[model samples]
Target: MTRPEAPHALAITFFYYRDLPRAMQFYEDIIGLPLAIDQGWCKIYQICPGAHVGLVDETRGMNKWSAQKPVQLCIRVVDVNAWYAYAREHALDGLSELFENDQLGIRAFVFHDPEGYQIEIQSATRAGA
Candidate 1:
Protein backbone atom coordinates (compact mmCIF):
# COMPACT_ATOMS: atom_id res chain seq x y z
CA MET A 1 0.00 0.00 0.00
CA THR A 2 1.15 3.55 -0.77
CA ARG A 3 0.52 6.67 1.21
CA PRO A 4 -1.45 9.47 -0.31
CA GLU A 5 0.35 12.69 -1.11
CA ALA A 6 -0.46 16.03 0.43
CA PRO A 7 -1.33 18.87 -1.87
CA HIS A 8 1.07 21.77 -2.25
CA ALA A 9 -0.08 25.33 -1.78
CA LEU A 10 0.18 27.98 -4.51
CA ALA A 11 2.86 29.85 -2.51
CA ILE A 12 2.25 33.19 -0.79
CA THR A 13 0.08 35.91 -2.17
CA PHE A 14 1.40 38.27 -4.85
CA PHE A 15 0.84 41.61 -3.07
CA TYR A 16 0.03 44.61 -5.21
CA TYR A 17 1.01 48.00 -3.87
CA ARG A 18 1.45 51.62 -4.99
CA ASP A 19 4.82 52.81 -6.28
CA LEU A 20 6.48 49.62 -7.42
CA PRO A 21 9.94 50.99 -6.57
CA ARG A 22 9.12 51.84 -2.96
CA ALA A 23 7.37 48.52 -2.45
CA MET A 24 10.34 46.76 -3.98
CA GLN A 25 12.72 48.42 -1.50
CA PHE A 26 10.52 47.52 1.45
CA TYR A 27 10.36 43.86 0.46
CA GLU A 28 13.89 43.50 -0.83
CA ASP A 29 15.89 45.70 1.56
CA ILE A 30 13.88 45.87 4.78
CA ILE A 31 12.10 42.53 4.79
CA GLY A 32 15.19 40.93 3.22
CA LEU A 33 13.34 39.03 0.50
CA PRO A 34 15.29 38.36 -2.67
CA LEU A 35 14.05 39.44 -6.08
CA ALA A 36 12.86 36.45 -8.06
CA ILE A 37 10.77 37.96 -10.83
CA ASP A 38 10.98 41.48 -12.13
CA GLN A 39 9.22 42.51 -15.30
CA GLY A 40 9.68 46.25 -14.80
CA TRP A 41 6.69 47.84 -12.86
CA CYS A 42 5.80 44.33 -11.65
CA LYS A 43 7.94 42.11 -9.43
CA ILE A 44 7.83 38.84 -7.51
CA TYR A 45 10.28 38.23 -4.68
CA GLN A 46 11.03 35.27 -2.45
CA ILE A 47 9.70 35.84 1.05
CA CYS A 48 10.86 32.68 2.73
CA PRO A 49 12.52 29.56 1.39
CA GLY A 50 9.58 28.68 -0.84
CA ALA A 51 7.24 31.58 -0.33
CA HIS A 52 7.09 34.33 -2.95
CA VAL A 53 6.26 37.99 -2.25
CA GLY A 54 4.86 39.72 -5.31
CA LEU A 55 4.30 43.41 -5.85
CA VAL A 56 2.12 44.35 -8.77
CA ASP A 57 1.26 47.80 -10.12
CA GLU A 58 -2.08 48.32 -8.45
CA THR A 59 -2.45 51.73 -10.05
CA ARG A 60 -3.44 49.97 -13.25
CA GLY A 61 -5.93 47.69 -11.52
CA MET A 62 -8.46 50.48 -10.75
CA ASN A 63 -9.46 49.00 -7.38
CA LYS A 64 -6.21 47.24 -6.63
CA TRP A 65 -4.85 46.80 -3.10
CA SER A 66 -2.20 49.47 -3.54
CA ALA A 67 -4.88 51.84 -4.71
CA GLN A 68 -7.21 50.93 -1.86
CA LYS A 69 -5.20 49.79 1.17
CA PRO A 70 -1.66 49.57 -0.32
CA VAL A 71 0.12 47.98 2.61
CA GLN A 72 -0.97 44.82 4.41
CA LEU A 73 1.84 42.31 4.35
CA CYS A 74 3.35 41.13 7.64
CA ILE A 75 6.42 38.94 7.85
CA ARG A 76 7.66 36.95 10.87
CA VAL A 77 11.41 37.15 11.16
CA VAL A 78 14.02 35.49 13.42
CA ASP A 79 15.77 38.66 14.56
CA VAL A 80 13.46 41.44 15.61
CA ASN A 81 16.28 43.76 16.74
CA ALA A 82 18.07 43.60 13.44
CA TRP A 83 14.81 44.10 11.65
CA TYR A 84 13.89 47.13 13.76
CA ALA A 85 17.33 48.62 13.34
CA TYR A 86 17.02 48.35 9.62
CA ALA A 87 13.60 49.93 9.74
CA ARG A 88 15.00 52.76 11.86
CA GLU A 89 17.93 53.33 9.53
CA HIS A 90 15.54 53.55 6.61
CA ALA A 91 13.17 55.84 8.58
CA LEU A 92 10.22 53.46 8.19
CA ASP A 93 7.21 54.26 10.36
CA GLY A 94 6.00 51.64 12.84
CA LEU A 95 5.60 50.82 16.51
CA SER A 96 8.69 50.57 18.71
CA GLU A 97 7.23 48.45 21.45
CA LEU A 98 8.30 44.83 21.79
CA PHE A 99 5.85 42.18 22.86
CA GLU A 100 7.04 39.15 24.78
CA ASN A 101 5.33 35.81 24.95
CA ASP A 102 5.64 33.89 28.21
CA GLN A 103 4.49 30.56 26.87
CA LEU A 104 6.89 30.50 23.95
CA GLY A 105 9.35 33.08 25.31
CA ILE A 106 9.38 34.79 21.94
CA ARG A 107 9.46 38.54 21.32
CA ALA A 108 8.42 40.69 18.38
CA PHE A 109 8.05 44.25 17.19
CA VAL A 110 5.87 45.87 14.57
CA PHE A 111 6.66 48.10 11.63
CA HIS A 112 4.21 50.06 9.53
CA ASP A 113 4.20 50.39 5.80
CA PRO A 114 3.65 53.59 3.88
CA GLU A 115 -0.09 52.93 4.02
CA GLY A 116 0.13 52.26 7.78
CA TYR A 117 -0.17 48.46 7.68
CA GLN A 118 1.85 46.66 10.36
CA ILE A 119 4.62 44.14 9.73
CA GLU A 120 5.58 42.06 12.74
CA ILE A 121 9.19 41.09 13.27
CA GLN A 122 9.39 38.15 15.68
CA SER A 123 12.34 36.46 17.33
CA ALA A 124 12.43 32.69 17.84
CA THR A 125 12.97 30.97 21.17
CA ARG A 126 15.70 28.40 21.59
CA ALA A 127 13.60 25.22 21.88
CA GLY A 128 10.12 26.55 22.58
CA ALA A 129 10.35 28.74 19.52
Candidate 2:
Protein backbone atom coordinates (compact mmCIF):
# COMPACT_ATOMS: atom_id res chain seq x y z
CA MET A 1 0.00 0.00 0.00
CA THR A 2 1.18 3.54 -0.72
CA ARG A 3 1.84 5.82 2.23
CA PRO A 4 -0.12 9.00 2.62
CA GLU A 5 1.54 12.31 1.75
CA ALA A 6 2.26 14.97 4.28
CA PRO A 7 0.06 18.06 4.42
CA HIS A 8 2.86 20.62 4.38
CA ALA A 9 3.16 22.71 1.23
CA LEU A 10 6.57 24.24 2.00
CA ALA A 11 9.65 23.40 4.00
CA ILE A 12 11.36 25.99 6.19
CA THR A 13 14.75 25.77 7.88
CA PHE A 14 15.36 27.96 10.89
CA PHE A 15 18.65 29.59 11.79
CA TYR A 16 18.90 31.10 15.23
CA TYR A 17 21.02 34.23 15.35
CA ARG A 18 22.24 36.49 18.12
CA ASP A 19 21.90 39.57 15.91
CA LEU A 20 18.61 39.38 14.09
CA PRO A 21 19.04 42.58 12.09
CA ARG A 22 22.39 41.50 10.67
CA ALA A 23 20.99 38.13 9.71
CA MET A 24 17.99 39.70 8.04
CA GLN A 25 20.21 42.07 6.07
CA PHE A 26 22.37 39.24 4.81
CA TYR A 27 19.41 37.21 3.62
CA GLU A 28 17.80 40.25 2.09
CA ASP A 29 20.60 42.37 0.63
CA ILE A 30 23.35 39.82 0.06
CA ILE A 31 21.57 36.57 -0.67
CA GLY A 32 18.64 38.41 -2.25
CA LEU A 33 15.85 36.20 -0.86
CA PRO A 34 12.43 37.77 -0.74
CA LEU A 35 10.88 38.26 2.66
CA ALA A 36 7.84 36.01 2.88
CA ILE A 37 6.80 36.44 6.50
CA ASP A 38 7.62 38.61 9.44
CA GLN A 39 6.42 37.27 12.80
CA GLY A 40 7.96 40.01 15.00
CA TRP A 41 10.40 37.62 16.62
CA CYS A 42 11.37 35.97 13.38
CA LYS A 43 11.56 36.68 9.66
CA ILE A 44 11.13 34.09 6.94
CA TYR A 45 12.73 34.44 3.51
CA GLN A 46 11.77 32.51 0.44
CA ILE A 47 14.83 30.80 -0.98
CA CYS A 48 13.02 29.32 -3.92
CA PRO A 49 9.51 28.36 -5.02
CA GLY A 50 8.52 26.20 -2.03
CA ALA A 51 11.60 26.42 0.17
CA HIS A 52 12.30 29.00 2.87
CA VAL A 53 14.77 29.99 5.53
CA GLY A 54 13.65 31.51 8.79
CA LEU A 55 15.94 33.75 10.80
CA VAL A 56 15.01 33.94 14.46
CA ASP A 57 16.27 36.04 17.31
CA GLU A 58 18.34 34.01 19.76
CA THR A 59 16.32 35.21 22.74
CA ARG A 60 13.13 33.91 21.11
CA GLY A 61 14.48 30.86 19.34
CA MET A 62 14.65 27.20 20.34
CA ASN A 63 18.45 27.22 20.00
CA LYS A 64 21.32 29.62 19.38
CA TRP A 65 24.32 29.69 17.13
CA SER A 66 27.36 28.20 18.82
CA ALA A 67 30.98 27.55 17.97
CA GLN A 68 29.88 24.35 16.32
CA LYS A 69 27.25 24.92 13.67
CA PRO A 70 25.05 21.87 13.23
CA VAL A 71 23.24 22.97 10.12
CA GLN A 72 24.12 23.77 6.53
CA LEU A 73 21.50 25.19 4.16
CA CYS A 74 21.82 24.01 0.58
CA ILE A 75 20.16 25.88 -2.26
CA ARG A 76 19.91 24.22 -5.62
CA VAL A 77 20.13 26.64 -8.55
CA VAL A 78 20.55 26.49 -12.31
CA ASP A 79 23.80 28.45 -12.42
CA VAL A 80 26.48 27.88 -9.84
CA ASN A 81 29.08 30.08 -11.54
CA ALA A 82 26.80 33.10 -11.55
CA TRP A 83 26.17 32.72 -7.85
CA TYR A 84 29.88 32.31 -7.16
CA ALA A 85 30.64 35.52 -9.04
CA TYR A 86 27.99 37.42 -7.12
CA ALA A 87 29.23 36.15 -3.76
CA ARG A 88 32.80 37.03 -4.64
CA GLU A 89 31.84 40.51 -5.78
CA HIS A 90 30.09 41.03 -2.50
CA ALA A 91 33.22 39.91 -0.62
CA LEU A 92 31.32 37.25 1.27
CA ASP A 93 33.50 35.39 3.76
CA GLY A 94 34.41 31.72 3.47
CA LEU A 95 33.50 31.67 -0.20
CA SER A 96 34.84 28.59 -1.92
CA GLU A 97 35.81 28.04 -5.50
CA LEU A 98 33.31 26.12 -7.55
CA PHE A 99 34.06 22.46 -7.77
CA GLU A 100 32.47 19.31 -9.12
CA ASN A 101 31.55 16.13 -7.30
CA ASP A 102 31.23 13.13 -9.56
CA GLN A 103 29.52 11.06 -6.89
CA LEU A 104 26.94 13.70 -6.15
CA GLY A 105 26.64 14.81 -9.78
CA ILE A 106 26.71 18.46 -8.77
CA ARG A 107 28.86 21.58 -9.07
CA ALA A 108 28.78 23.86 -6.06
CA PHE A 109 30.39 26.39 -3.77
CA VAL A 110 29.95 27.41 -0.13
CA PHE A 111 29.96 30.58 1.94
CA HIS A 112 29.25 31.54 5.51
CA ASP A 113 26.40 33.68 6.69
CA PRO A 114 26.69 36.40 9.33
CA GLU A 115 26.03 33.90 12.12
CA GLY A 116 28.42 31.35 10.65
CA TYR A 117 25.86 29.06 9.04
CA GLN A 118 27.23 27.37 5.93
CA ILE A 119 25.19 28.02 2.80
CA GLU A 120 25.89 25.87 -0.21
CA ILE A 121 24.76 26.86 -3.70
CA GLN A 122 24.81 24.06 -6.19
CA SER A 123 23.69 23.07 -9.67
CA ALA A 124 23.37 19.72 -11.34
CA THR A 125 26.20 18.93 -13.75
CA ARG A 126 25.33 18.64 -17.39
CA ALA A 127 24.97 15.08 -18.72
CA GLY A 128 27.48 15.38 -21.57
CA ALA A 129 29.68 18.18 -20.24
Candidate 3:
Protein backbone atom coordinates (compact mmCIF):
# COMPACT_ATOMS: atom_id res chain seq x y z
CA MET A 1 0.00 0.00 0.00
CA THR A 2 1.17 3.50 -0.84
CA ARG A 3 1.16 6.23 1.79
CA PRO A 4 -0.74 9.47 1.39
CA GLU A 5 1.23 12.70 0.93
CA ALA A 6 0.38 16.07 2.36
CA PRO A 7 1.67 19.29 0.87
CA HIS A 8 2.25 22.39 2.95
CA ALA A 9 0.53 25.59 1.84
CA LEU A 10 2.30 28.05 4.14
CA ALA A 11 5.08 28.26 6.71
CA ILE A 12 4.73 30.18 9.96
CA THR A 13 7.18 30.59 12.83
CA PHE A 14 5.49 31.47 16.11
CA PHE A 15 7.04 33.67 18.77
CA TYR A 16 5.47 33.95 22.19
CA TYR A 17 5.50 37.44 23.66
CA ARG A 18 4.53 38.98 26.94
CA ASP A 19 3.61 42.17 25.10
CA LEU A 20 1.88 41.27 21.90
CA PRO A 21 0.93 44.85 20.98
CA ARG A 22 4.53 46.02 21.23
CA ALA A 23 5.71 43.06 19.19
CA MET A 24 3.00 43.69 16.61
CA GLN A 25 3.97 47.36 16.36
CA PHE A 26 7.63 46.55 15.85
CA TYR A 27 6.92 43.92 13.23
CA GLU A 28 4.42 46.18 11.48
CA ASP A 29 6.02 49.65 11.68
CA ILE A 30 9.69 48.70 11.84
CA ILE A 31 10.02 45.36 10.11
CA GLY A 32 7.28 46.33 7.63
CA LEU A 33 5.71 42.91 7.39
CA PRO A 34 2.07 43.04 6.41
CA LEU A 35 -0.44 41.38 8.68
CA ALA A 36 -1.71 38.23 7.07
CA ILE A 37 -3.97 36.96 9.83
CA ASP A 38 -5.43 38.43 12.98
CA GLN A 39 -6.53 35.91 15.56
CA GLY A 40 -7.42 38.39 18.34
CA TRP A 41 -4.48 37.45 20.56
CA CYS A 42 -2.20 36.41 17.74
CA LYS A 43 -1.00 38.43 14.77
CA ILE A 44 0.53 36.69 11.79
CA TYR A 45 2.78 38.76 9.57
CA GLN A 46 4.02 37.75 6.20
CA ILE A 47 7.80 37.82 5.89
CA CYS A 48 7.81 36.95 2.23
CA PRO A 49 5.94 34.80 -0.20
CA GLY A 50 4.57 31.79 1.70
CA ALA A 51 6.63 32.57 4.82
CA HIS A 52 5.18 34.21 7.93
CA VAL A 53 5.97 35.05 11.55
CA GLY A 54 3.21 34.73 14.09
CA LEU A 55 3.20 36.77 17.27
CA VAL A 56 1.18 35.35 20.12
CA ASP A 57 0.20 36.83 23.46
CA GLU A 58 1.80 34.69 26.12
CA THR A 59 -1.19 34.98 28.40
CA ARG A 60 -3.40 33.40 25.78
CA GLY A 61 -0.89 31.37 23.85
CA MET A 62 0.12 27.75 24.34
CA ASN A 63 3.69 28.76 25.30
CA LYS A 64 4.73 31.17 27.99
CA TRP A 65 7.29 33.95 27.58
CA SER A 66 10.87 33.17 28.47
CA ALA A 67 13.57 35.62 29.45
CA GLN A 68 16.11 34.03 27.17
CA LYS A 69 15.47 33.76 23.45
CA PRO A 70 17.82 31.29 21.77
CA VAL A 71 16.21 31.45 18.34
CA GLN A 72 17.28 33.89 15.65
CA LEU A 73 15.13 35.12 12.79
CA CYS A 74 17.11 35.53 9.59
CA ILE A 75 15.85 37.30 6.52
CA ARG A 76 17.61 37.15 3.17
CA VAL A 77 17.23 40.32 1.14
CA VAL A 78 18.35 41.57 -2.21
CA ASP A 79 20.38 44.43 -0.72
CA VAL A 80 21.71 43.94 2.78
CA ASN A 81 23.58 47.27 2.70
CA ALA A 82 20.35 49.15 2.11
CA TRP A 83 18.65 47.31 4.95
CA TYR A 84 21.65 47.93 7.17
CA ALA A 85 21.43 51.64 6.40
CA TYR A 86 17.77 51.65 7.37
CA ALA A 87 18.50 49.67 10.52
CA ARG A 88 21.20 52.17 11.47
CA GLU A 89 18.84 55.07 10.88
CA HIS A 90 16.38 53.52 13.32
CA ALA A 91 19.20 52.90 15.84
CA LEU A 92 18.03 49.37 16.49
CA ASP A 93 19.07 47.57 19.64
CA GLY A 94 22.27 45.49 19.55
CA LEU A 95 22.85 46.33 15.91
CA SER A 96 26.14 44.96 14.63
CA GLU A 97 28.41 46.24 11.90
CA LEU A 98 27.77 44.69 8.52
CA PHE A 99 30.27 41.95 7.71
CA GLU A 100 30.84 39.32 5.07
CA ASN A 101 31.16 35.61 5.56
CA ASP A 102 32.79 33.88 2.61
CA GLN A 103 31.93 30.44 3.91
CA LEU A 104 28.24 31.32 4.07
CA GLY A 105 28.48 33.46 0.93
CA ILE A 106 26.55 36.20 2.66
CA ARG A 107 26.99 39.82 3.66
CA ALA A 108 25.00 40.26 6.83
CA PHE A 109 24.31 42.20 10.01
CA VAL A 110 22.44 41.28 13.17
CA PHE A 111 20.28 43.18 15.65
CA HIS A 112 17.86 42.62 18.47
CA ASP A 113 14.12 43.09 18.34
CA PRO A 114 11.96 44.82 20.95
CA GLU A 115 11.99 41.71 23.12
CA GLY A 116 15.66 40.89 22.43
CA TYR A 117 15.13 38.32 19.70
CA GLN A 118 18.11 38.37 17.38
CA ILE A 119 17.29 39.20 13.79
CA GLU A 120 19.79 38.83 10.96
CA ILE A 121 19.56 40.44 7.54
CA GLN A 122 21.73 39.05 4.79
CA SER A 123 22.40 39.16 1.09
CA ALA A 124 24.11 36.58 -1.05
CA THR A 125 27.68 37.51 -2.01
CA ARG A 126 28.22 35.00 -4.77
CA ALA A 127 26.24 33.44 -7.58
CA GLY A 128 23.86 30.63 -6.65
CA ALA A 129 24.37 31.36 -2.96
Candidate 4:
Protein backbone atom coordinates (compact mmCIF):
# COMPACT_ATOMS: atom_id res chain seq x y z
CA MET A 1 0.00 0.00 0.00
CA THR A 2 1.15 3.51 -0.82
CA ARG A 3 1.20 6.09 1.97
CA PRO A 4 0.78 9.81 1.64
CA GLU A 5 3.48 12.14 2.88
CA ALA A 6 2.95 13.74 6.25
CA PRO A 7 2.43 17.47 6.20
CA HIS A 8 4.52 18.35 9.22
CA ALA A 9 8.17 17.66 9.89
CA LEU A 10 7.54 16.77 13.54
CA ALA A 11 4.68 16.10 15.93
CA ILE A 12 4.75 17.27 19.54
CA THR A 13 2.43 16.49 22.47
CA PHE A 14 2.38 19.12 25.17
CA PHE A 15 1.68 18.54 28.86
CA TYR A 16 1.08 21.24 31.41
CA TYR A 17 2.81 20.74 34.74
CA ARG A 18 2.68 22.65 37.99
CA ASP A 19 6.42 22.25 38.40
CA LEU A 20 8.28 22.48 35.12
CA PRO A 21 11.76 21.68 36.40
CA ARG A 22 10.62 18.46 38.07
CA ALA A 23 8.94 17.32 34.89
CA MET A 24 12.00 18.25 32.86
CA GLN A 25 14.28 16.30 35.16
CA PHE A 26 12.05 13.22 35.03
CA TYR A 27 11.96 13.20 31.25
CA GLU A 28 15.63 14.09 30.83
CA ASP A 29 17.29 12.05 33.56
CA ILE A 30 14.90 9.14 34.00
CA ILE A 31 13.18 8.70 30.66
CA GLY A 32 16.32 10.00 28.90
CA LEU A 33 14.70 11.96 26.13
CA PRO A 34 17.02 14.60 24.71
CA LEU A 35 16.13 18.25 24.90
CA ALA A 36 15.05 19.32 21.43
CA ILE A 37 13.99 22.89 22.17
CA ASP A 38 14.06 25.01 25.29
CA GLN A 39 11.53 27.75 25.13
CA GLY A 40 11.55 30.11 28.10
CA TRP A 41 8.32 28.77 29.58
CA CYS A 42 8.10 25.42 27.79
CA LYS A 43 10.70 22.72 27.18
CA ILE A 44 10.49 20.24 24.33
CA TYR A 45 12.05 16.79 24.38
CA GLN A 46 12.66 14.61 21.39
CA ILE A 47 10.95 11.26 21.82
CA CYS A 48 12.13 9.78 18.52
CA PRO A 49 12.96 10.77 14.98
CA GLY A 50 9.89 12.88 14.33
CA ALA A 51 8.02 12.95 17.62
CA HIS A 52 8.50 15.27 20.59
CA VAL A 53 6.95 16.14 23.96
CA GLY A 54 6.60 19.64 25.35
CA LEU A 55 6.51 20.38 29.04
CA VAL A 56 4.79 23.62 29.93
CA ASP A 57 4.54 25.34 33.26
CA GLU A 58 0.97 25.59 34.51
CA THR A 59 1.33 29.28 35.21
CA ARG A 60 2.37 29.89 31.62
CA GLY A 61 0.21 27.28 29.93
CA MET A 62 -3.41 27.57 28.85
CA ASN A 63 -4.72 24.67 30.98
CA LYS A 64 -4.18 23.39 34.51
CA TRP A 65 -4.59 19.99 36.10
CA SER A 66 -7.10 19.66 38.90
CA ALA A 67 -8.74 16.51 40.20
CA GLN A 68 -8.15 14.59 37.01
CA LYS A 69 -5.47 14.30 34.33
CA PRO A 70 -6.55 14.14 30.72
CA VAL A 71 -3.48 12.76 29.03
CA GLN A 72 -1.51 9.55 28.81
CA LEU A 73 1.80 9.59 26.95
CA CYS A 74 2.65 6.18 25.52
CA ILE A 75 6.10 5.57 24.14
CA ARG A 76 6.84 2.61 21.91
CA VAL A 77 10.31 1.26 22.52
CA VAL A 78 12.55 -1.64 21.52
CA ASP A 79 13.08 -2.82 25.11
CA VAL A 80 10.16 -2.63 27.48
CA ASN A 81 11.91 -4.85 30.01
CA ALA A 82 14.89 -2.52 30.26
CA TRP A 83 12.64 0.43 30.93
CA TYR A 84 10.65 -1.51 33.49
CA ALA A 85 13.86 -2.36 35.31
CA TYR A 86 14.95 1.24 35.28
CA ALA A 87 11.65 2.36 36.67
CA ARG A 88 11.85 -0.23 39.39
CA GLU A 89 15.31 0.95 40.41
CA HIS A 90 14.31 4.58 40.44
CA ALA A 91 11.18 3.88 42.54
CA LEU A 92 8.95 5.58 40.07
CA ASP A 93 5.35 6.23 41.06
CA GLY A 94 2.58 3.91 39.88
CA LEU A 95 4.87 1.31 38.38
CA SER A 96 3.25 -1.73 36.80
CA GLU A 97 4.63 -5.10 35.86
CA LEU A 98 5.22 -5.89 32.21
CA PHE A 99 2.25 -7.65 30.64
CA GLU A 100 1.07 -8.73 27.23
CA ASN A 101 -2.03 -7.47 25.51
CA ASP A 102 -3.10 -9.62 22.61
CA GLN A 103 -5.68 -7.03 21.69
CA LEU A 104 -3.05 -4.31 21.44
CA GLY A 105 -0.28 -6.68 20.27
CA ILE A 106 2.22 -5.33 22.77
CA ARG A 107 4.10 -6.11 25.96
CA ALA A 108 4.04 -3.02 28.15
CA PHE A 109 4.32 -1.52 31.59
CA VAL A 110 2.85 1.65 33.05
CA PHE A 111 4.26 4.26 35.38
CA HIS A 112 3.70 7.80 36.48
CA ASP A 113 5.93 10.79 36.04
CA PRO A 114 6.72 13.21 38.86
CA GLU A 115 3.46 15.05 38.37
CA GLY A 116 1.30 11.94 38.09
CA TYR A 117 1.26 11.82 34.32
CA GLN A 118 0.71 8.32 33.03
CA ILE A 119 3.53 7.05 30.85
CA GLU A 120 3.35 3.69 29.14
CA ILE A 121 6.42 2.00 27.75
CA GLN A 122 5.78 -0.83 25.36
CA SER A 123 7.22 -3.04 22.64
CA ALA A 124 5.50 -4.79 19.81
CA THR A 125 4.78 -8.46 20.52
CA ARG A 126 6.29 -9.42 17.16
CA ALA A 127 7.83 -7.75 14.17
CA GLY A 128 5.27 -5.11 13.08
CA ALA A 129 2.76 -6.67 15.48
**Which candidate leads the pack in TM-score?**
3
Q: Which stretches of candidate 2 lie over 4 Å from their true place?
A: 1-6, 127-129
TM-scores of the candidates in the order shown:
0.71, 0.90, 0.95, 0.91
Model 4: ten consecutive residues of lowest lDDT: 62-71
RMSD of each: 4.0, 2.6, 1.3, 3.4
lDDT of each: 0.69, 0.90, 0.94, 0.90
For model 3, name the residue pairs that clash. Answer: none
lDDT tens string, model 1, 51-70? 77667787754347633444
Give the RMSD in angstroms, all C-alphas superposed, for model 1: 4.0
Candidate number with the higher TM-score (1 or 3):
3
| Candidate 4: tens digits of C-alpha lDDT, residues 39-103 | 98899999999999999998888877554776799999998888888889998899988899998
Backbone clashes in model 2, listed as residue pairs = none
Which whole-number lDDT from 0 to 100 does residue 111 have in model 2?
Answer: 91
Report the C-alpha lDDT of model 2 over 1-129, residue by residue, as the tens digit.
888787778889988889999999999999899999999989999998889999999898898668778789999888899999999999888999889998888999999999799999999886753
Put down candidate 3 lDDT per residue, 10-54, tens digits, no spaces.
999999998889999999999999999999999999999999999
**Candidate 3 Cα outliers beyond 4 Å, as residue runs:** 1-3
Query: Ranking under TM-score, best-scoring first?
Result: 3, 4, 2, 1
